[model samples]
Target: MLQASDITYTYNGGLKLVFPNISCPTGQHWLLLGQSGSGKTTLLHLLAGLRTPTTGSVSIGGTDISKLRASRLDKFRGKNIGIVFQEPHFMRALNVEENLALTQSLSGQKVDKKKIHTLLDRLNIAHKLKSDTSALSQGEKQRVAIARALINDPVLILADEPTSALDDKNTREVISLLEEQATAAGATLLVVTHDNRLREQFPNQITL
Candidate 1:
């Protein structure tokens, strides 16, 4: 569902970061493994169209996203891609449900309360719907972020260091939640992290 051809990026005044070619098929789950400063997160951002590449192309579901106009890219990304960041950034004043509702509105998609409730339930955060985001624990907040990512029913899911702050159990739970939901929705999942503990869980790996 996603392909990156001859991708290259440079920073720190012409220092090249790893930008080898990469590709993944539909329904595949990929783990991008690399240590600090290895360009794992950079590659993830490029694939998600959050960062434009200096050269080469990133195509998602057959469209060359790197070539899209800024306005068109925003709309296409909202509908085709979902991202879970290392830190779950939510509106401090909004409740869980409200935060998710706002996400739907921002994406220009109709709100589906049932789908929202079902995703929260799947992530074991259904009871926290009425709770303010500021009152939740880190793990709880992560679950909420996952729910928000799934709310749009995106075709490609990209997660960056999602398990960084979680304990072993929570890490497993978070990975399981992402894997299960992505597979059920027929969305491609790409998780970028330095966590080797996850290797046993996902056999496929793309090391940078």
Candidate 2:
């Protein structure tokens, strides 16, 4: 489960963005909607533990991540929080399999080839295991990103504008895939997007 309260952030330029509290229980799915400059991404970062909120508490699975030391927070995030960014970033030189393996290594886990293969197979990208990440099509890369996020069986999955660029059909497909994967992992899924088409897809929604 994920819980956040009194969340607020201040940009270096003196801009302050306050966010609503979020309480998403385990295995639940929620959608967060807002416009382009509505701080959707900022809130996602705070919830993911990528950025510290100016004032507030963020707890995941009963651990107050906001107060954790930098080193411990890094480890905790690696094991429990999975984030799929609007743009997938990968080491250009690494193959698909190697990229996923790197995530495990960073999290202090030994590379699990079998798990990597199994996840890729489920995402329908097993054939691209040896392919360079840059060589995959946009859709394929997004699928790989999803696979990477699920590789460690994170308890919380936070996706930022995952389907913003896709057509209606692809949007539905990607949303379905995210929901299916999160359910399989028993993880709480929170998607932050400006896409209103998704409003109907997730009944529990918060608007900024």
> Which model scores highest in TM-score?
2
lDDT of 2: 0.93
- The TM-score obtained by model 2 is 0.98
Which RMSD values do the candidates have, in order? 1.2, 0.8
Q: What is the lDDT of residue 195 in candidate 1?
A: 90
Quote the lDDT for 72 in model 2: 94
Model 1 segments more than 4 A misplaced: none
Indicate the worst ten consecutive residues by lDDT in candidate 2: 80-89
lDDT of each: 0.89, 0.93
Candidate 1 lDDT, 3-95, residue by residue in tens: 999888877599777577778889889898999889888899899898898889999999999999888898888888989999998998889
Give residue 114's error in model 1 in angstroms.
Answer: 2.4
TM-score of predicted structure 1: 0.96
